[model samples]
Target: MTKLETAFAPVAPAVDLDAYFARIGYDGPREPTLAVLRAIHQKHPDAIPFENIDVLLGRPISLDPAAIDAKLIGAGRGGYCYEQNGLLKRVLAALGFQVEGRMARVLWMAPAGAPPRPRSHMVLAVRVPGDDAAWLADVGFGGCVLTAPLALFSDDVQATPNGDFRILPIDELGGERQVQADLSGRWSPTYQVASGAWADVDYEQANFYTYAHPSSHFTFSLTAGRTTPTARYALKNNRLTHRDATGALVDQRDLSAAELEAVLRDVIGLPVEPDWRPLLEKIVAWGSAA
Candidate 1:
């Protein structure tokens, strides 16, 4: 069997491949390069949802391909990096693309001189045929996600409905990279990929830190979001912010604890059990206080 087939063969045992593809809106001939990407973008919104439901419930996040597939594709749930991007990497590889799992440190730019703090984030780099630079594909980030693959050297601004994005080299930090959108000129720091080759195990270890660390934002927030052509629906803490097509913040409403739980189940389409209602209430309470 080919490397690609072998990597994903085990995934099928745990997940129905056809059902998984249908869940993500993937329906086309298997073309590793661009077809899979377009399928994901068409079906799944750019803003996937980085949530801490499992963390709050004391369930350890699994980095295994089958486990991720079970949570996302099988159970009809959304997840953070380890679950979202990790599964995307497997799917890409199974479609014959050269995929690498990478870790990124988040650096959020602030107004008036606030410093950037590093947080753990996960993404993937894929080497497509006839392409010199690896394309960054991520379906896990809460707000900003690439709708299409980006060339490594090009600084040309790629426009998404949400914002304009570009990646440029950072010389000051010893070759660190920065990706920025029109929303902020201050570039958000993603991962610094090592020149040497990385094994899947390397990403597995990094995934552990991201999900298990107390400092990770995924540990703190039950954030979920979805992006449409004209607007964005984001559930951050107890407040939901809707940004319009013109990049204006259109609406921001704070929800009560009970209302927040209802929104999660009714609006966002996440299935919450009776036992989980209290946890959702706790998250809403924390969000209100924050």
Candidate 2:
């Protein structure tokens, strides 16, 4: 094992490859080729969604590979960045891909002059053997998740199943990279990736802050997102919104409490837990009072 792999070995267990494949409905090749990577990347988010229900419920988020597998795959539940990309990290490694963990500060939807956020988002740097360029494989970014891998250093626009994205140099020294997406003719920053690859400890610390910190939005809001071949779905509180592949709004509506439950279960494809109702109730009630 490589030093990075050895360092992460203890905490990272081999994912249930068969179960994961079945969950994503992916029957493609298992090689670490770009084609295989693209296929899996596209299918993962379509199957497993991005959500923060556990955080909102005041439950601790565990980064153990086994724990992530049990909750996300076994229970058919969705999770936030740490859980989503962390699980993907193992799955890709098991498939013989040279996958490394990376961190990013989210700039998506932030005010123009707001302070920089913490490095709470998790993304993957994947090196396909014999491929000269590294590919950014992230299926964790909500609302605007990447459905296909993009060349890590490329500044040109790259198209995916969901939308168009580009990674541009943000610093004069070229130490920082910014990920942007074309949202209806307007390019918007999603997150800025730090220079080096992240270690296991980095994920643990970031994951903790993302779920536990008072300033973290995950603690208070009910958010879930997923992408399909044709459209993207984003749900916040009692509102569910849908956008087309071109990043144009297709349809959006406020969902009732019962409708929220149904949408979480059916639309978002999460195996809704009974205990989540009280939290969901609070979300609906909060929205009603607003």
Error of 1 at 156 (Å): 1.0
Task: Return the TM-score for candidate 1, rounded to 2 decimals.
Answer: 0.83
Instruction: Give the backbone clash total of model 2.
Output: 0
- Residue 169 in candidate 1 has what lDDT? 72
Per-residue lDDT tens digits for candidate 2, residues 1-290, read: 89999885754568899999999999888998899999999999999999998889889999887889999999998898888888888888888888888889899999989998877788999998877688999999988999999998988999998889999998948578999999998999999988788877678877888889898888888889989999899998889999998789999998888999999988899888888888889999877776
What does candidate 1's lDDT look like per residue over 209-241, in tens digits? 666888765677777766666766678777887
Q: What residue pairs clash in candidate 1, if any at all?
A: none
**Model 2's lDDT to the true fold?**
0.89
Candidate 1: stretches off by over 4 Å = 1-16, 46-48, 109-119, 172-175, 184-197
lDDT of the candidates, in the order given:
0.66, 0.89
